[model samples]
Target: MGSFHAMHIETRVTGFIEENCYLVSNPDTQEVVVIDPGDDAADLAARLRGQNFKVVAYLLTHGHVDHISALADLCADFPAPIHIHPADAAWCFTEQNAILGLYPAPRKPDCPLVDATEGMVFELAGASWTVLETPGHTPGCICWKLDAANALFAGDTLFRDSAGRTDLPGGNPRALTQSLRKLAALPDDLRVFSGHGELTTIGREKRENFFMQF
Candidate 1:
């Protein structure tokens, strides 16, 4: 019953980075938000239209290129504000060299960006989500949690059997450990929806994720 009204998170691999673009919507309001419109701007928009959604904003868990390559295109389609963690905002264009130095083209300036903080709560599609500051893969990386749905939009942070690599720029092994600890504390029933890869439950990860102790 609880999952009935829970926000819908749809994933599509678009553009050059192979980043997953998630369309989160409130079934009740038909209002939607796009998370990390990584590359396929047109595809994401088409999908949104097919669902009869009123997209209100584009939220980025971080500013990595693969996660934001199609951000400009998405902003044009939805005409919404672009939100990201302040720490990773600069990465939007700078592509600062770090362990994540290698990958798609260097990031270039394109869209208007906004900063979000931990504990910040916002309403969308008649529901609310808590922003968790879970940085490890990137200094400003985060995960959005919708407690009502027992779901988490974990960017490149925690995965099913493993966690994001800290070998890239702005990554810190110690920080990732701390982030994993925090995620591990969530209820086992919670479903983790990551930026990339298959979705898994917190309980499943806790039991088998070797990188993090459940």
Candidate 2:
């Protein structure tokens, strides 16, 4: 749980993979930002309605099965544009993305798919949002930065004492290293909301995460 001024943030560990889904909402405005609705579409949807959240947008940190498996399902009920990097948008919901036993291919939502370009800005939950394109785990991987909270929504790119593996499809160790360098340059006080595991700070990762050091 976190707060962006009066807005509320709830983290739901969903699906078998335990991907973190973030619901950032401003109760006064009834507007919410849905980040990486990986799995458990039913529960995710229920939680939103239960809280009277009006989803303003669906932001994808990247287009991995564990990160976006529930996107299509959620979009069906909540009509909002989906924002993802063009690189990931190219092949995210195809049959090629299907995992043998872990996940099935995700369907393309009927709603709009906007290219979440680097440095693109947005206003949601009464906070300023910046899109940082960090391609490593996937070509279209991105980290959402919330200036109000000084938080980085790192989706499988940088983790606690670890970084996202580049051995997966479209993974690139070199690109990941470059991305980490970019994050390392940010303010040490910025809170890191990792895609998995416990939360950490940029300063802590710079000292403890070997990948960040490299």
Candidate 3:
């Protein structure tokens, strides 16, 4: 077994709206990935210090304000490369200009944007995660698939009962519907780890998620 045999991948729901920030690490390697450090920078950093996990990279599921408020703070302390899809990258530093006008906290990005490409893979805890573009809630929204853990880190594109609103800038109702269709087709056994709210499974969503209904 690898160091991550019993790895502690904790998820903290921070910010006023309860955005999810995931800390994934491999104890053996002491390396970790921080996903969506939306708020409470000091608190998040403290948690990292306690775990002694060296943050290797910062992953943004989208550029929405609630999902990126603590980005600068995370970048400052970890100094890890920031990765995001190019579509919504410009909104990172300019909340006032966000198409949705819902950027809760605005801060500039420390490094240039990192493109989330198809087939692009990143390793964590000796396992791999594949990035899948699933736009609708945002033009650059992405879902990270951790097949080893049978988890899908879905951003605002998907939820438990309903789907993300396409009323915001760059949001397309038709596109969102199409994206939902794609997600609906995934294996029912895959665990659906959303950016907000409670955790669910693809099977549960398929059967009860009204938005994903065919």
Q: State which candidate has the highest TM-score.
A: 2
lDDT of 2 by residue, 76-183 (tens): 999899989999999998987998989999989888998888999987667788999999999999999987777899999999999998998899999999999999
Say which prediction, candidate 2 or candidate 3, comes out ahead on TM-score.
2
Model 2 residue 111 distance off true place after TM-score fit, in angstroms: 1.0
Q: Give the alpha-carbon lDDT of every model.
A: 0.77, 0.89, 0.79
Model 2: per-residue Cα lDDT at residue 44: 96
Per lDDT, what order, best first?
Answer: 2, 3, 1
Q: How many clashes in each structure?
A: 7, 0, 0
Model 1 agreement with the true structure over 1-58: per-residue lDDT tens digits: 2254567777887755466778877787788888877776677778887888897777
Candidate 1 similarity to native, TM-score: 0.88
Off by over 4 Å in 2: 1-3
Query: 41-61 in candidate 3: lDDT tens per residue?
Result: 899989888878888878888
For residue 94, model 2's alpha carbon misses the true position, in angstroms, by 0.6
Q: What is the C-alpha RMSD of each candidate to the true structure, in Å?
A: 3.0, 2.0, 2.4
lDDT assessment of candidate 2: 0.89
Q: Tell me the TM-score of each prediction against the true structure.
A: 0.88, 0.96, 0.91
